[model samples]
Target chain A: MDLIQKGKNYLLEDNFQIRASDNYVNIVSYDKMIHFDNKEVKIQYRNKVITVIGDKLVVSKLVSDEVLVCGMIQKIEFR
Target chain B: MKHYIEVRIEGKNIYRFLKRLNQAKINLYHIRYHGINQAYIKILKEDYEKIQDLKTIYDIKITNWYGIEKGKKIIFKYRFFLLFFLFGLALFIFLSHIVFDVEVVHNDKKLRLLLQEELKKYGISKYHFKKNYDEINKIKKEILYRYRNNIEWLEIKEVGVKYVVRVEERIISKEKEKRPIQNIVSKHNAIILSIDAEEGEIIKNINDYVKPGDVIISGEILLNDKIQKRVSAKGKVYGEVWYKTTVEYPLFYQEQKITGKTKKGWSLSLLNKRIELFSFSPFRHKKIFSKPILKSNLLPISLNYERQKELLIIEEALTKEEALEKAISYARDKIQKSLLEKEKIIDIKKLKVDQNNSKIIVELFVTVYQQIGMEKKIEEIKKDVRDH
Candidate 1:
């Protein structure tokens, strides 16, 4: 759980490599895979927490050597 | 706060690149695959700048984002028109059902009546909906086939759901043959005033006295004193005759003075039903009297009514002179109805009188023209026409 929290925090606070788009985004990852169904999008490390708003979040351990915060879907936000 | 950016590609290998992006944890919505080499895609707005950097990596072109904006507007715009069109269509269907007419025709009257009963059974009467045309047509065909021999033509037509049927009747015409004539004679002792002949001939001459059923003219025609051809002859003959009579009156009588007062009221009754026109009252003196005059005609639309009333009167004793004068007037009126045509009163003379305790019986002899029993027969004459 701590590692999951650590990975979530890393994706939210740290600026990872991503390709921004109108409906979706592509990201590279170097961590264990993380899955979420458009909910519980948070990473808390000590007293610092990183929050992301989207439909889903994912983590993948790949040779890219970077934590990929994929699934940057448009989160529902009201004005 | 993610803003989606839409992308359109106008080059080859676009699908392959899109699949690569999906594998890299990219989600897409409102994505349309135009063809094998072309595609349009929408992505998060925050990733807009990053996807623009990959423009050099893939041969992609971002065309105008008109399709998405137009699609969103279309959803709301057509909602108004769709509801209005449905409302109009429903109203038209309802009104069409209300005013549609239906008719049925058959050559045979028996078959026509039978079909009418069947149509009524199926709720297809004079006023029926056109939308029910198909069902009604099926029913009509079944009926026609049932009476195929009786019906020559069967058609079901609809003009905006109205139907009309006309029928023809087959029959033969025949002329009426003549029947043997029975001479129409006067029931009373009256001259043949006039005759309205439908088909007959007249043979009796004027002033010829006729008896009942005596052949004044024969319907059997005779030529040169021998029967030749037959035709009915018809006409009327008026004959001058005489009748006389005298009435006797009493010399003493009680008369009532007329006060000339009346009460008016009306009553109604059903046809052939008897109803009393006035209510009877049991009161007053025993000598008081009332009279009823009944008058009824076919034109008034009423069965009948009686006009009855009691006359206010005072009883009075008659003098000898007044009694004699009244008796003479009564006798004159009696002979007036019995007088015949051209009959003159030859003389009137008092004969005798006999007096009782309170009344005097007076008699007279008045003479007038009269024809004694001379029976004349009305013969039926028959004529032969050249047209035959």
Candidate 2:
């Protein structure tokens, strides 16, 4: 149809989004938090699972956009 | 906008509680984990109940609070003190603009009473609201103008809540003080008609002719033509004096008598142009007495009360004899006004009369008996006993 409608459909339709920086990770459209601890946090969206491994990792902010984990982030693994 | 607060949540399943909070659309900020099971998070104050409902599944304890709720609790705790402080500040501002007492600085009781009355009329009395600088200056000017002969200088000073009025009385300077040992000299070359001496020896008798500067009443108390003591010569020495006056009388006289019907109204004047308000019935011949109500110093515009009194004019064609009699009376009045209260007019002799155009000019010699005593200090001769 139109470009704006296509963009709205893209935003509304089920899609997983993740942003990771040196100190924090922001995730959007996640199903739930599978596990959370001092050293790592695991989140699952649809049929996929995302793993965040870090030191002193904590959920700094949370909204409908899943969670934002902040700390010394070493690596992120998705399966 | 909802106010958010930072609270510490203590529970065994803290992570599960955060997940449930996010699912409920409750936003959290600045989260920190003290331990694995205990975490601190920020949430909106209204959403605290949802977190409380999860207490059955987990043991939830609130450790601290923050933001708008914290501020509201602190304000509610000291609301009474804040109210009293605000009320006190408002009262201070109101009391500063009120006058509690008026103090008039003067020694004379009558003068103080008069000034107080004048100040009361100008709205500067006790318990009145304080006036600004310009208004006070205007009031001072009005009072000075109303009592110009009574007050020479006036000052209105404000000290805290009191109005202190300082005034100076206008004392009319009288004649210079007479010496203790002085003589009353004849002021003019006349015949002394009467003498009333309060102190001193009478040197000249009644009906005696005297010249100017001649001592009529002496201060020296003499016994057998020898001086004993001296005193001030205080008395009224009545003498007959003459005046040569020429008065011009009109052949036709028009006397204006006020009918006593006076009308007072407002008048606005711009420069030399005046406009009277509510002047439906006008007086044909009127004498207007006006006092300014509002005057502009910068512009030539003023508003004043115009008190107009109706004048009744009586016109009469005078004959030669009537004109001459009127002229003699006018001359007698002129000389009589110059005399004191006790002084009397003895006679008026017409010397000459001449008709000029529409009037007659009469030359008259007027005789008035008045006090002619003027004090003259005596020169005392000091003969030193050591020189003798």
Candidate 3:
């Protein structure tokens, strides 16, 4: 597991999870790191996530890993 | 430390940037804005390093400026003094008019009125201001020279805009006294004391009382009731007149120094001033008469400096011997003043001075020399009134 999964597993042991479709890190289930090639993508680490809608950055919850960028909408890819 | 940098941000960005800069402890000494947009900021050298990093946050521009703040302050200070100096100068120029005083002096009212009218013609009147001194002086000189024979001297001096014209007039003695030639007659029934006769016939004896209007010395002589010759009946009749003069004793005489033993100074009429026989005294105990001048009296002028004298002021004290002699002398003088033709004193028999209640009362007994009597007769003069 990556450092992101390690921080997420630590939260999962305390009944925490990361939700992808809602663009947030919550207590849903253990989810792997989902990287996207689209410009609008949600980045998750530990029990928190941030969605970058174009160049604008938005944080969904209080977490150690959060970053968002929102501007011109362009292509996106997951990693 | 980061290198220093300056920033010129939009006007709307100043509030946010200044707040952030202040939170970061960036010292801003001088801050100025131009056209409501660009702001020049001066910061401490320590804060310059960190402020340069905020370029990405604020559009920053660097510009070098000289010390314009201190220069503006100095200019304001000098401008203030210049304004005050100008105000004071204007005030001084404004108050240079307005006559301070007007003085008029003259012996004759008619002359004063004439002079006043003449002065009015030359724009000189009471309460007038804005008078030109040189022009007034020239005008005054012209007028005075036109009447040089009448006017003695005149001068006009100016203090501020007020003028003082002092004048002096020529002296003109213009009076004559006339004496009447009349016959001398006895005023009452009395004994003849003494007589100094010019030309007259004696008729009565001494220690004899004569009737009123009775001729003490006759102008004409008569033998057996017939008129003989005519003569001038001129003589002084003096009698033993009783007088009681009371003078307060311990007269508490007070005298001040009159003549200063130094070079003359500005005169004061009171004590500490002396009148040389030539110079006139300004003050007198009494005034007998004053003659005024025409046109000169209205100009604060004096025609003459005649000194008046009063006998009440005693310059020197009288000793015991001097007092007795003076008493007799004063009695003699009184008798002489009362007589028509001058006569001498024959006797001062009784003189007693008694001090009572801070006073000395003197009673003098006197007998004077005079003509003895009058020859009573009227001679008829032949006057032919045929010539029309």
* Candidate of highest DockQ: 2
- What are the DockQ scores of the candidates, in order? 0.03, 0.40, 0.01
- Give each model a TM-score: 0.33, 0.50, 0.26
In model 1, the Cα lDDT at residue A60 comes to: 24
Q: Between 2 and 3, whose lDDT is larger?
A: 2
Quality class of the docking in candidate 1, CAPRI style: incorrect
lDDT of 1 by residue, B1-388 (tens): 4455567755556544554554454554545555455666766544455556655556555443344554655666797887888899998877777635655665466766766776667666666544365785787777667766555555656656566565443344456765444443433344543444443445655455565444544455666788665554444433333334334444445455444444443344446553545546621322223232443565333433334344544555666556656776787666767766644455566676656665555667665434322223223222312232
In candidate 1, position B311 carries an lDDT of: 50
lDDT of 2 by residue, B1-388 (tens): 6777767777777777777777677788768777767778877777778878755656555555676667777778888988898899999988988899989999999999999998888888888889999999999999999999889999999999999999999998888975668888898988999999999999899999888778888988999999998898888899988778889999999999999999988889999998888899889889989898999999999999999999999999999899999898887777778777999899889999999888999998878888888888775212222344
Off by over 4 Å in 1: A1-79, B1-24, B27-84, B94-99, B102-122, B130-156, B169-171, B175-178, B195-200, B206-217, B224-226, B229-388
Decoy 1 TM-score against native: 0.33
What lDDT is reached at residue B120 by model 1?
69
Pairwise TM-score winner, candidates 1 and 2: 2
